[model samples]
Target: MKGALREALQRARVDKVPVALVTQLEGGAQNLVYSSDQSNAEISLGSSQLEEIRDMLRVARSGMLPGDEFFVRSYVPPYRLLIVGAVHIAQALSVMAAQCDYQVTVIDPRRAFATAERFQGVELCAEWPDEAMARLLPDAQTAVVTLAHDPKIDDPALIAALGSGAFYIGALGSRRTHGKRLERLTDLGLEDQLQRINAPIGLKLGGRGHAEIAVSILAQLIQARYGG
Candidate 1:
C-alpha cells in the first residue's frame, strides 16, 4: 500500500498539474490536513498518518474537494507575461511585471541583447519572432507586449499575440505612426487584428523615453487586462 501510494504521488508530480493529497495523520488536531503542493506530500511510517488517509486521498484523486487550501492554492494558476522584444522598454517592464506577480518571459532573436547580461533574471529566448511566440501563446491570464517598433520584430510578434487568448495585447507607437502601421497591417490582411491591438499604446499620459513610457504602457496593459 505504501509503495502504491508513493508511485501514485510520483505520477501526479510528473504530470505537473496541481493535485490535492489528502491523508489522515495519527491522533492529532491536524490529522485531516491535505497537501496541495507535491513538495510537501510525504508519508513516513513513524511520521504518523491515519490508516484511512489513503482512502481520503483516493477520493481526492477522483476530483473531490478536500480542504480550503486545496481549493484555493491548487486551482489557481500563475499569471504569465510574454514580452516579444528584449528592448529597453522590455527591460523596465519586465521588472514591473514581476513585482505584480507575472511570470515574465522575453523573446528576441538578437543574441547580444537577449543575453543574461542585459535581461538578468528574466526568461530571455533568442528565437525567431513567430516561432518563439508559438511556445508562449496567451491564455486567460496572459498579457503580451511588443516593445520593438521594427516590423521585422514587432509585426509577426503582434500577429501571433493577437491570434491568442492574451487578455492584453499592446504595441508601442505614436498615433501617427499607428496610422501608418495600420495601413501596412491592413495591406497584409491584418486590419481586424490591428483594431484588436492596444496601439498608440499606453494611456494618454503624453510621456516619452523608455522608463516613463514603459510605466504608461504597463498602466494601460494592466487596465485592459483587469479593468472593466
Candidate 2:
C-alpha cells in the first residue's frame, strides 16, 4: 500500500498536480486508498507551502499505522516580493508582509543593517540598488516597496517598479521628500509614470513609531491587493 501511494504521489508531482493519498483500513482490509484530484482542491490555505488538507485526509483514512507517515510536501508559488531597505520600519513591514502570502525578500547595500539577525525570516540581499534590482524579473503580482530613503537605492527601484506592472508600488518618505523625489523622477523620463506611485506610502493613521507606521503601510497594501 505504501509503495502504491508513493507511486501516485510521484506521478502527481511530475504533472504539477496536487493530490491527497487518503488511506483507510476497513475491518480486515489492510489499506484502502483515495485521492483528491488537484483540480478539486477546495481550500485556499493562505499560501502556506503545504497541502495540509491532504495530510489530514490521509491520517483520517488510515488511522494510526506505526510506520505510516502522512505529510504534505511544501507547495511553493512563482510569486515574490522585493523590499529595498534594512531599517526598523522595513523590518516590521517585512514581518507583516510575509504573513500576507508573500515570499518576502529584502534588499539593502548597507551590510551593517542587512543581516540575518535583523531580517530573521527574510531572504536578505545586500547589493547595490540597481545591481540587485536587475536580478528580479517581477510579474504583475509582484509587490515592490522602497523603504530606503536614499535616492541611490529608492530612486532606482522606484523607476523599475513604475516600468513593471507590480501589483503594489510604495515608497517611504514625507510629503516634502516625495515632492522632491517626484521632481527627480520626472527628470528621468518618468513624468507620466507619477500616477503609478503610492508616495508617502501608508494610510493616515497619524502615528510615528516604527512599528505603528509599519502597520499602517502594510494595512493599505493589503487593502489594495485583496480588494478590501
Candidate 3:
C-alpha cells in the first residue's frame, strides 16, 4: 500500500512480470519479491523464503508460508493465447481458451477467415503472422498456436514464437507433414529451436473433429503451463 511498493507493482503489471507481495502477519511489514531478475532493495529474504515465494509465483497461488508468519499474495500477468491463422480449429480453440481465462487473439492476413462473425468475442488480428507476433511480443505467459496449416503463415509465426519467451508453441500437422515442416524450419536455421514446438499439436486424444482437436490442444497447453 505504500507509494514505492504501489509503483513497483504497477511497473510489474505493465511489464507482465510475476511478483509476490509478502506481508508479515504480526508486524505488518511488507516486501515485494519478483519472479525474475527484478528485486526489492527494501528487504532481503533468506534463500528458503525466496524459494517458497517463487513456488507461489509459479502457481499464481496466494497463501501463508509454512509458519503462518507471512502471507504471500501472487500477482501474475494474465495468461494469453495467440492463435496464428484464424482457421476452423482456431475458432474452436479461441472459444475454449477464453473459457479457461486466456486472453485470446486470432491472427491472420486473410480478412475473410479472421472476421468477427466467425470468431465472436475474440481479438482478431488482420495482419500477417510475423507482424502480429512482433507487435504482440509474446511473453512467458503467452501461448502461440499455428492452425493455419499454410507454410507461408504458420512458418513465420513459428519462427517468431520460437524466438520469443512464449511458454507454449504448438502447430497442427500430421506426422509426415511435420517431418516436412521440420525440414523446412531446419533449412531456415531453426534446428536448435525446433524441439520447443509441439508439432502434431495436442495430446494423443484420438479425436479428429475440430472441437476434439481443440480440446486436445488446450489440454496439452494446460499441461505445459503447469509443468505436467
| Top model number, TM-score | 3
lDDT of each: 0.68, 0.71, 0.91
lDDT of 3 by residue, 1-228 (tens): 688888988898899778899888786778888876445544566889889889989889999988888889999888999999888889899999999999999999999899989988899999999899999999888999999989999999999999999999999999999999999999989999999999799999999999999999999999999899
| Clash pairs detected, candidate 1 | 24-50
Q: List the residue pairs that clash in candidate 3.
A: none
User: How close is each model in CA RMSD to the real structure?
Assistant: 8.2, 9.3, 3.2
State the displacement of the C-alpha of residue 190, model 3, in Å, after optimal TM-score superposition.
1.1
User: What's the lDDT of the predicted structure labeled candidate 2?
Assistant: 0.71
Predicted candidate 2: what Cα RMSD to the true structure? Answer: 9.3
> Candidate 1: lDDT of 132?
81
Better of 1 and 2 by lDDT: 2
- Pairs clashing within candidate 2: 23-61, 49-75
TM-score per model over all chains: 0.68, 0.68, 0.83
For model 3, the superposed segments whose C-alpha errors exceed 4 Å read 1-17, 23-51
Report the lDDT tens digits of candidate 2 across residue range 1-228: 455555656666566443443333342122222243343233232222233444544332223433343223332243467889889998988888788777888999999989999889789998876777778756566888888899988998888888888888889999999999999999999999887788789888999999899888888777776668
- Give a tens-digit lDDT track for model 1, residues 34-73: 3422333343322233323333443333332344222211
